[model samples]
Target: MATTSPSERLLKTICGSCLILAPAVLLVGGLLHPEETTNAARQFEIIVANLGRWELAHWLIAASMLLMIGAVVGLAHLLHEHRPTEGIIGGATTMVGVMALFAIASAEAAIVPQIGRSGDAQLFASIVTSGGFWVLLGPVLLLPLGLIIMSYGMYRSRVAQTWVAGTVALGSAAFAVSLPTGSPVAFAIGLVLMFVGLARVGWSVLAETDEQWHHPPQMGAQLAG
Candidate 1:
């Protein structure tokens, strides 16, 4: 087995955390979906009404936040270790991606319970249509942009698969454009992209590290002697 470095371990840990949190938050969002009406105000009401559940979601989001912080710190270490521009850029891009997610999650956490309790989908939709949900747009819409940039950095550094990075870029773009059309298929595709990209990055890290362990060079071995 290849010996692992502290820095790599740290990166893996952070990335693993991110991997775990992404799905967890998504799962929570799904659980709350039935409660979320089209109405933004009602969403707020639901959040308020279901304080305990909402609070639990909020606490669960800490995992995501911790992952982001760890990624940022790990990126710094990667930069220091290699002085590579790609590392710096990738790290910063990841920071932005996580930050956007955190913001989105935070906003949703606030308003979900409210709307959930309002029990009026039409009213919620009206509020969202009236720009009440505009705040949600930034985090939802802009996240893919950050992800694309991060993917680009990963592609350039060869830290991740090229196809995965490309998918993230394309998927983000699709989601951004599809928001206005409200196309479920397109939106689903976009979600798939983001989730797949994240998963790929995490899996790649583990695979790369494992490969290193199993393929270490032989000591005092002659080169084609």
Candidate 2:
């Protein structure tokens, strides 16, 4: 058992919570989402008219992305322990991507909802529904890019099992791929993969922490020495 700092334990907890809960909230929002097709104005009307309908999903999705940044950073800390001299560039890129993801999520959620508040039906209908290019492209590129970087760093760090690192990286890529495909089911799978991979890393760290708590390294070292 090895020692873990308080920051490490907290990071593991936050990352684990985000990994476990983000997807669940997103899934619920997806389920609660309106299933019918309507004109942009009509859709905007519904969204504005009933914030309750999709607000949870909106917040959850944004929050999840925000937390992902933490997850990346926390995982990086562990991976750094193994490969001190390698993977700095990848980690920095991933951090930038995560920041971009948060910004995108925040901007989109804020803007789209404003249409509702404005009560301009024509404007809502007339306005763009694409959520802007940056928002659209942010997750498609940034999120996966971060995860892949984290995965690479983890692999290089030798902190994670080969399969764990590989699966997580693959899952991140798969999720990113599904984003552009415009398929809800496929998107869900990607989210699942993101959650799965993150959960693996977070959980591993927590487990290690618990082991260290129960069996401190000093005790083992004393025995060995």
User: Whose lDDT is greatest here?
Assistant: 2
Error of 2 at 211 (Å): 9.6
Clashing residue pairs in all predictions, respectively, total: 26, 1
Tell me the tens digit of each residue's lDDT in model 2 across 1-225.
466678656766776566556545544544565432335656776787676555566566667666656665556556554553334555566666656655655654676567677777676655556466435466447657766776776666556666666776887677677555546666666666666666665555455554542342221122121
- lDDT, candidate 1, 1-225, per-residue tens: 457678666666665456535634543543433244455555556655776676566545534555545544433332333335645665565566557657756765666445656666665566568774465556545445555655565555544456766876787677677655666567567656655766555444344443332331122121111
Indicate the worst ten consecutive residues by lDDT in candidate 1.
216-225
Consecutive 10-residue window with the lowest summed lDDT within model 2: 216-225
RMSD, one per candidate, in order: 7.3, 5.9
Report the number of backbone clashes for model 1.
Answer: 26
